[model samples]
Each structure stands twice: as structure tokens, then as C-alpha cells.
Target: MTYCVGLLLETGIVMLSDTRTNAGFDNVACYRKMFVFETTGERVVAILTAGNLSVTQTVIAKLRQAIARDDPEHSIMRAPSMLDVAEIIGRTLNDVHVAVNERMERTKYSASASMLVAGQRLGGQLRLFLVYEEGNFIEATDDTPYLQIGEHKYGKPILDRVVTPETTIEVGRKAVLISMDSTMRSNLSVGMPLDLLTIRRGEYRVSTRERIEAGDPTFSAMSEAWGNALRDGFLSLPG
Candidate 1:
């Protein structure tokens, strides 16, 4: 299991993903789940994924290969618009999902994968898409400026309370960490180090990228402080 979340705010986007892939009680591993493609000042896109490692990794590898290809037909970087890029991703992901699922059937393994895509092309508006394993997708609108996949239940409350289209970049980043902290406390399958990024609107560049490890002092402090505050708040709540 994994936990991945992305927030599109007024100033930018905050994305985070855990690196855990659990096969069984004794078969758990870590793999980076965040990816970024940026052409500073022109295009900036980030993908956060959660699910079967093979499916997600293959999807990413193919996407990267497609974009790096010389043929315009396969390059997502040359897409005319953000919508086109998203459509391309959806189409490719769906194809990959089908192929991987076919193999899984014989092996009796699950190929569950979902990804959150967020980015902007120079002349295009910032857009965010939640892409499922089936290849279908939905964009984040002002009404719901965030998306999450995998082991999300434990961390959703912070996002519901503090994230919004108008939220500041700083706040969104903090909120995501708090959300991750909540999930980490509840799920052993979701562990550090966490991958995070901030893409500022219009800059088409990633402003910050970080890895929050198990003993990162700041993260540890934040998690402890958040927990203490929650405890105090719970005690003050009306019965």
C-alpha cells in the first residue's frame, strides 16, 4: 500500500508520496513514487503514484520513453496543450494497465495502480488530474483542489480541513506533511522517506523538492507538535 497526495493552490502545487510497496508481511520495500518533468519557464509536470510497483513503474518508464523519443507522435512534451498531455497520459496508462493486468491473471498477483498528475505548459493553465488504473481521469477544480490515492483514509481529514484552491503554497506544503504524518502513524505499509515537491504557478519550475526520512528532525518535530495539538483539541471538544 502507499499514500500519495497533491494539492493545487493559488500559488502553486504541493505533491507528496510514500515509497512503500507491500507484498506480504515479510515482503515490503521502498520505491520513489514522485516524478517531475520540467522545462523551467515553459512546462512543469509532476506525477505521484501509488499501487502495484510493476504497473506504476512501467507506466512511468513508458511515459518517460515516450517523451524522450524523437518522434513527435510519442512525445508528451510536445503536446499542444495540457489537456492533450493529460489525454495522452490517460491513453498510455490505460494501455499499460491492460497489458500488466493480463500478465497478473496468470500469476495471481494484483496490478492496482493510480496516479495524480499536476503541471502546466507555458501558455496553458495549471491543471491537475487523478488518473486511475483504468485510464480514466478527473481534473481538480476550484471546488476540490486536491486528489489522493492509496491508504488515504488516515490522512484525509487534514486536507479536508485545510486545503483549498486559494490556500497558500506554504500552507499547502505543511498540510500535506501533516496529512502524511497522520497516515504514517496508522499504516506500517506506508513508511519514510517521503518524496515531496512544490511547483510554482507560471514559473513552470519546481521550487522545492525534498525527501523526508524517518529521522528528519523537522518532520519529527512537526509530527510530534501536530499530535500534541490534536490531543489538546480532542480534550477540549464538547462531549
Candidate 2:
């Protein structure tokens, strides 16, 4: 399993995903779950994937193939707006899931995948979407300016408490890292290194992209601070 989250804020968008993929206790490997595409000042998009690795990888490969064609109608880079991009991704994911599952049917194995899409076009608003395996998707709204996929329950509480449309990019980044830390502590299937991406509104390009390795000092310090704060908060409550 994996854990991926995207935050839609007034200033921009923030996304994070872990790299761990596990088939069993002894069969663990690292594979990046974040993919980004951009034409630098014109358009930018980021995808965070979760679920069956085969399905997710095929979906990404097909999307890249479409982009390589430069077909305005089919390429996410040429899609009119973020909504169109989401639709394209949803369709691709659904198609890939069906094909992979059919191939696996002979062995009674099944494959499925989901993704979180976030991006902005040259003249469009920043948007975030959660795409399901069935070619359907929902966008993040002002009421709930964040979307998450995989091993999400353990990390959701921090997002619910700290994320909002008004959140600053800095705060949103911290919130997501803390959320990931919480999930990692509670779930063995999710591990590091992590991919973090931030795209500021109107830039139509990634403003920051960082890979948090297992022993990254800054992330380590942040994680420690968060744990300490949580413990202090719990102790402060009246008994």
C-alpha cells in the first residue's frame, strides 16, 4: 500500500506520497508514487498514485504516451483546464484497471488503482481531484480543500484539524508531512523516502519539489517536534 495526499489552498497546491510498496513482510521495495509533468510557465500537473503497482504504472505509461503524441484533445498538457486533465486521467486509470484485471483473471488475481491529480493551466485556477478506478472523480472544494489516497485514516485527523482553503503554502507543507508521519507510525505498509511537490497559483510550474529520504535531518527534526507536541497536548487535557 501507499499514502498520498494533496492539499488545495488559496495560494497553491501541495502534494506528498511515500515510496514504499510491499507484497509481504519479506517482499518490500521502494517505488516512487509521484509523477510530474510541466511545460514550465505554461502548464503543470502532478499525479500521486496508490493501489496495484501494475495498474498504476500502466496508467502513467499510457498518459505519457498520449502526451508524447502532442494531441491537444488527448494530451493532458493540452487539456483546456484542470477539469479536463482530471477526466483524461480518470478514463486512463479505468481503462488500465480493466485491461490489467482481465489479464489477471486467469490466475484469479485482480488489479486496481486510484490517483490524486493536481495542477493549473496558464489561464486556469489551481485544481485538485481524486480519481477512482471506475473513471469517476471529484474535485476538492473550499469546504474541504484537501484529498488523500491510501493508508489515509491514521493521517486524516491532522489534515482535518489544520488544512483549509486559507492555509499558507508553508503550513500546508508541514501539515502534510506530519500527516505522513502519523500514517507511517501506524502502518507498516507505508514507509519512506517521500516525494513532496508544491505548485504556487498562476506559476503553471512546480515551485518546489523535494525527496525526503529515510534519514533526512530536516524531516527527522520536524517529526520529532510533532510527536513532542502531540504528547504535550494530550498531557495538558484535564483528567
Candidate 3:
């Protein structure tokens, strides 16, 4: 299990994901779940994946292979718009998911996975999409400017109450980190270090990419503050 979230704010986009992969109590490991593709000034696409590690990894690998081979029809960098890039990723994820599930049919394993795709190309609109296991996707709209996958329930309340399309980049980043922190505290399957990325509007490139490890001072302080706030708020309620 894992947790990944993406916010599409007016100033830009913010994405976060945990690195823990828990197959079982005894089979736990860390694997990067955030993948970024960019051509410095031309375009930038970031993918946050959750679900079966095998399925997600293969889908991303295939996407990269297409780019390395310069296969225009399938390469995300060559897509005319961010929408088209989402389509390509959706298609790839769906295909890989089905194939992997079939191969694991005899076992007790599953190959279901989902992804959050966010990016922009030079002269294109910055957009975000939630690609499901079925090769279908939904875009983030003004009404709901965020998308989340994998162990998301534990962290959704903060986003629902605070995030908006008008949120500034810095605020959006803090929101996501708090969101991830909430999930981590409630669910052992999702743990640090975490991958975080941000893209400023119109830049056509990633503005920041960071890894927040367990016990990182900034994150730790924020998490502690949030906990204190929650307890205080609860205590203030009339009984």
C-alpha cells in the first residue's frame, strides 16, 4: 500500500507520494513511487503512482522506453497537449495492469494500480488527471482541484477543508505534506521518506523536487504542530 496526492492550484501544481511498499508484515521495502519526465524548458510531466508495485513500475518503464526510443506516437513528451499525455499514460497503465493481473491469476496477488498525472507543455494549459486501472481518467476541475490515490481516506479531510484552485504554491505544498503526515500517522503501510514536486504556472518545468525523509526537521515540526492543533481543537469543543 501507498499514498499519493496531487493538487492543481492556480499558481501551479503540487504532488506528493510515500515510498513504502508493504506486501506483508515481514515484506516491507521502500521504492520510489514518483516519476518525472521533463525537457527543461519545453515540458514537464510528473506521475504519482499507488497500488501494485509491479504494475506501476512496468507502466512507467514502458513510458520511458518509448521516449528513449523516440516513438512519437507513444512518447509523452511528443504529445500535443497535457490531455494527450494523460491519454497515453492511461492506456499504458491499463494495458500493464491487465497483463500483470492475468499473469498473477493463479497466485494470491493482484495487479491493480492507479496514477495521478500532472504536467504542462510550452504554450499548453497546466492540467491534472487521475488515471484508473481501467484506462479511463477524470480531470481536476475548479470544483475539486485535487486528486488522491492509495490509502487516501486518512488524509482527505484537510484537503477538503483547505485546498482550492486559488491556493498559492507554498500553501499547497504545506497542505500536501500535512495530508501525507496524517495518513502516515494513521496507517503503517504508508511511511517516509516522501517525494514532493512542484511546477510553477507557465514555467513548463518543475520548480522544486524534494525528498522528505523520516525525522526531517521541517516535516517533523509541522507534523507535531498539526497534532497539537488537532488536540486543542478537540478539547475546545463543548461537551
Candidate 4:
């Protein structure tokens, strides 16, 4: 299991994910669940994934191979629009998922994966989409400006309460870390070495990317500050 969260704010987009995958207690390892594709000034895309590692890796490798082949029909870089890129990834994920599941069927194993794609094309709207294991996807809207995958429940409350289009990039980053801290405290499957990233709108580049490890000073401070704030808020509440 893993955890990945994406925040769509007024200034830009923020995404974070853990690097752990586990088949059992003895089979734990680190694999990046976050993937990025960009052309510096022209376009930038980041994909945060969860579920079956095999499925996600293959799907990404196929996408990269297609791009390398200059196969315009299957290449995300050749996509005419961000929506088209989302569509291509959705189809690839769906196809790869089913194939992997079938291969693992004899062992009674299930392989599945989902990806969150966030990026913008030149002259196109900055958008975010959650593509499911089945190849279908839903876009983030003003009403729901965020999407989460893998162990999402514990961290959703803060996002629901405070995130919005008017949110600043700095605050958005804090919110995601707090959100991840909450999930980490609650679940054993999600661990440290989190990939935290930000893509400022209109820049077509990821302006900030952070690798937060256990006991990182900034993260430690944020976690402590959040705890203090909550305690104070609770104590000051009228009973």
C-alpha cells in the first residue's frame, strides 16, 4: 500500500506520495510511486500512483516506449491537449491492469493500479485527473479541488476544511504534509521519503520538488506546529 495526494490551489498544484510497497511483512521495499514527464518550457506532467507496482511500472514503461517510438497516437508528448493525455493514460492503465491481472490469475493474485495526472499544455488549462485501474477517470473541479489514492481516509479532513482556489502555494504545501503526517501516523504501510512537488500554473515546469525523509527538520517542525495548533484550538473551544 501507499499514499498519494494532489492539491489544486489558486496558485498552482501540489502533490505528495510515499515510496513504499509491500506484499507482506517480509517483502517490503521502496519504489517511487511518483512519475514525471516534462519538456521544461513546453509542458510538464506528474503522475502519482498506487496499488500493484508491476501494473504501474509497466504502464509507465509502455508510455515511455510509445513516446520514444514517436508513435503520435499513443504518445503523451504528442497529445494535442491535456485531456487527450489523460485519455491516453487512462486507456493504457486499463489495458495494462487487465493484462497483469490475467497473468497473475493462476496464482490467485490481483494486480491493480491507479494514477493521478496533473499538468498543463501550452495555451491549455492546467488540469488534474484521477485515472482509475479500469481506465476511466474523473477530473478535479472547483467543488472538489483534490483527489487522493491509497490510504486516503485519514488525511482527507484538513483538505476538506481549508483547501481552495484562493489558497497560496506555501499553505498548500503545508496542508499536504500535514495530511501525509496524519496518514502516516494511522497506517503502517505508508512510510517516509515522501516526494512532495509543486507545479506553478502557467510555468509549465515543476518549480518545487522535495524529498522529505524521516526527521527532516522542516517536516518535524510542521508536524509539531500542527499538533500544537490543534491542541490550542481544542482547549480554547467553549465547552
Question: Number of clashes in every candidate structure?
Answer: 0, 0, 0, 0
lDDT of each: 0.87, 0.94, 0.94, 0.91
Backbone clashes (count) for model 1: 0
Q: Report the lDDT tens digits of candidate 3 across residue range 183-239.
A: 998999999999999999899889999999888999989999999999999999997
Instruction: Compose the digit string of candidate 4's lDDT tens values, residues 131-189.
Output: 99888899888889999999999999998998987889898888889999999999999
For model 1, where is the 10-residue window of minimal lDDT? Answer: 68-77
TM-score, one value per model: 0.96, 0.97, 0.98, 0.97
Give the C-alpha miss distance for residue 28 in model 1, angstroms: 1.7
Instruction: List ranges where model 3 is wrong by over 4 Å.
Output: none
lDDT string, candidate 1, 89-208, tens digits:
777788888998888798877687888999999888988899987888998988888899999999998899989898999889899999999998899999999999998888888889
True-structure RMSD for candidate 4: 1.1
Whichever of 1 and 3 has more TM-score, that candidate is 3
Per-residue CA lDDT of model 2 for 1-239, tens digit only, reads 89999999999999999999988789999999999999999999999999999899989998999999997777999899889999999989999899888889999778878999999998898999999999999999999999999999999999999898999999999999999999999999999999999999999999999999998999999999998988999999997
**lDDT for 214 (candidate 3):** 87
